[model samples]
Target: MTIRISRRRLLTTAAATSIGVLAMPYLSRAADRPQITHGVQSGDVGADGGVVWARADRPSHMMVEVATTESFSHAKVLPPIAALPESDFTAKMLLENLPAGQETFYRVRFRDLAHPAISSEPAIGRFRTAPADRRDVSFVWGGDVAGQGWGINPDDGGMVTFATMRRHRPDFLLHSGDTIYADGVIAAEVKLADGKVWKNVTIPEKAKVAETLDEFRAAHKYNFLDDNVRAFNAEVPIFVQWDDHEVTNNWSASKQLPAAYKERSIGLLAARSARAFHEMYPMRESLAEPGRIYRTLHYGPHLDVFMLDERSYRGANGENQQTAYGPESYFLGPDQLAWLKRGLLNSRATWKVIASDMPLSIIVYDDAANRSGSEAFAQGDGPPRGRELEIADILRFIKSAGIVNTVWLTADVHYAAAHYYNPDKAQFQDFEPFWEFVAGPLHAGTFGPNQLDNTFGPEVKFIKAPGQGQQNLPPSAGMQFFGHVRIEGATGQMTVTLRDRADVALWSTTLDPRPGKPG
Candidate 1:
């Protein structure tokens, strides 16, 4: 009845083996042990509870214990959750009745049901529950990992930006989509602009574009294999969303896949990618609607985050004609738009944060000819068209409702910048002024300072892009970027800061709740 656990034994046997080094001696000592392969993660942190997640090397009953203290002297043990093959042997448990606005420590272990005594090395993680009342909250938002042929390179610190973000110790991380480059292949060696070859640890599944369900799952799994990513996930609860790279580049429901992915339809690929995404991340699944990823989360009375699913229900990237726009031409479909409107109107929080996977004003041009289209909201240089129409409607509604302090955070651009959109100088002046901050390519190449469409008058504040016309700057050169937001509970002021891989602030700006229209 007494199961003795040893941290030393666990670290020596399990942790030591995963860091790009072989632990043959430890493996020999515990050949049958259920190893916690992907490390531990916590997410969906509510005021009273949160979710703890872990994966086992084999089918086992996963156990989680939560406590306020690191020692876990008075830990609350949750019911055992089965790590089944159906879910790739990953298990998650909801820890309820946890104190709000406080750091909660948790430990996870896997036990063989047949042999109750045998257990895996315990994996530890921590998360902070949402505040029950007004409290200062800070969180980081960014995306586009292992993109532009940049994969995990253990020799070069392996996505070191994740470790840097972890150092900030944000309450949660809003991963603004592109969780994996499912459609992008990672080669063993990539030739950079400086004629230096950047090496990557290439796995079979990541060597080619993902098509099969298992391959898609492997793509998501590849991220966790990195030590830095695993360490970051352990402490920060992530609010995940999906972008085009999760399936393919500039993908939509209507677009036909190239001959390479002829075996799988776009819908099937999206489904497979979504399933893998849900399985790998610790996001809360809705019981009412199981597969829905777009939802809202309230962090105390100060912030309400609306995580959008841009890739799920979208029109074709080439549907850019203003006259061709209708119900079918949607970025955020009618249903999602209605839901967003309702959520924005119903929210009592001071700041309504739209965690968009893509930027609105930036011209994300598609590969189609005529130069007449974009993958994002912008369609033309003038007024709202196609997807931009939907955005304009939402912004107009927000302004008419007098919803202040609305901010948009996105990361698909592969660079970091701040843009303040003002209706005073816009073509369609129905919407009030707002700020949209873009940062990303977390471990990918740096590119943009993308051109802005005047559909909504957006003035660029600051931008940090790759120099010398080089887009694919290796991570080792320190071009990666991410943004952090800190909301002061007392003054209701929000400070947004963009930082590079070196943890140096690229840009920082403080905004009052409603700055009363920019001059």
Candidate 2:
């Protein structure tokens, strides 16, 4: 419950002060006596700046610093930063005015002022700046890496997925949701006498919190403890947002959770979770503001990425007719809907990618009693709220506005699948062709086993579940994999490739947005 740094290693009051203020004696070198337990982490990279972070194994509060160069040998280390008692012993430092489309290295050392406190060997990694002009760029993003368990094979799951993505060398990583399973429950693997099996169980300790602030903090630390998860983070710059699991599954804005929020005294559960989310992820100010996680990033004029917040503005589940299936009745709230509409309408990019935590489309088994699957299990009242955003209306809006170059990238369905949405539902409206691509579980287990058939084995359209050809693990609905989206800004062409941890390209597809025409 507490994080402490020992003062025994204090630099001679005058010795450490000289590090940046003045030249200190050649106290020590990182390689000579390294004390870092985890590797380095960098995030929030923009044309102007980014964050450099790391943790130490020894007890010490030292200053954290960074340099624009991959080797700190000739770079400047900023002021010494002491670790706050609240965050255990982790240190996150901001580096400003970093060069674009380049690499940076950072170091962490403790104070005792007497020595360098055996700094951790610095980590060097590369990142790309938002294209300043129309040029090609590529990136990857997906979320909900809850822990692994059940009959799952660790070697063949999330860890493998991270290895797959590492091969792509994306500019940044966008984590959509459920970065950690805060509820902390797993399947019981046994059938209850009442004929109800506990497919998911919420841990009692995490459930007993009076305020969600501490609860969410606990969840973050749990995620950082995973080795494979930490490695994926070390390699890429991460832009993140919260989904249901970070707090509670399927939480809509202001929607109450009787078992959890009902006991909280301070701020709403959503607010508490949001704070914890930002504190843990090195996300920039764009998504840091409350109720405004929606924002647009333009990779030159080649691609315009719109990250949306669907659950917050969503209408409660159930059969309540009257309004058109969009905007006013959108899964995206008022502010977000408007922003998205304007962003889409104004985009001149070759490709428009909408990053959403929930699938724009997924199976919604109506009828509450017979309902199953993850989303249904997390809904409120009536038959499962199957596709409430009025899939029809949203698609129409995209077409009507001439937002021709658009594609949706999403996770959370637990299974990786690709499909095109027809504004014209095949059953009714003429199908308007818009495509969607999905990937998953960076360092979390493959989707919790499917209820009836235990379908981790891929029978659907997708590639081999990583290593399955060489070693093999159960196939997954969304086989633990990461998404690699490569776009040629010049040609307005996009190529998507999915890879397993073994660096094998599993599945891929291409899309071409020719001015205002469909691909």
Best by TM-score: 1
| Per-residue alpha-carbon lDDT of candidate 2 for residues 14-84, written as tens digits (9 for 90 to 100) | 33443643343333554544345445666766654566665554444545444445555444445565544
| Candidate 1, superposed: residue stretches over 4 Å from native | 1-28, 323-325, 368-372, 515-519
Per-residue lDDT of model 1, residues 324-442, tens digit only: 55755788888899999999888888889999999988887786345545688877678787788888889999988877789999999899999999887788889888899999889
Give candidate 2's TM-score.
Answer: 0.72
The estimated TM-scores of all candidates read 0.92, 0.72
Tell me, by lDDT, which candidate is best.
1
Give RMSD to native, each candidate: 6.5, 8.5
Tell me how far candidate 2 lies from the true structure as C-alpha RMSD in angstroms. 8.5
Candidate 1 lDDT (Cα, 0 to 1): 0.83
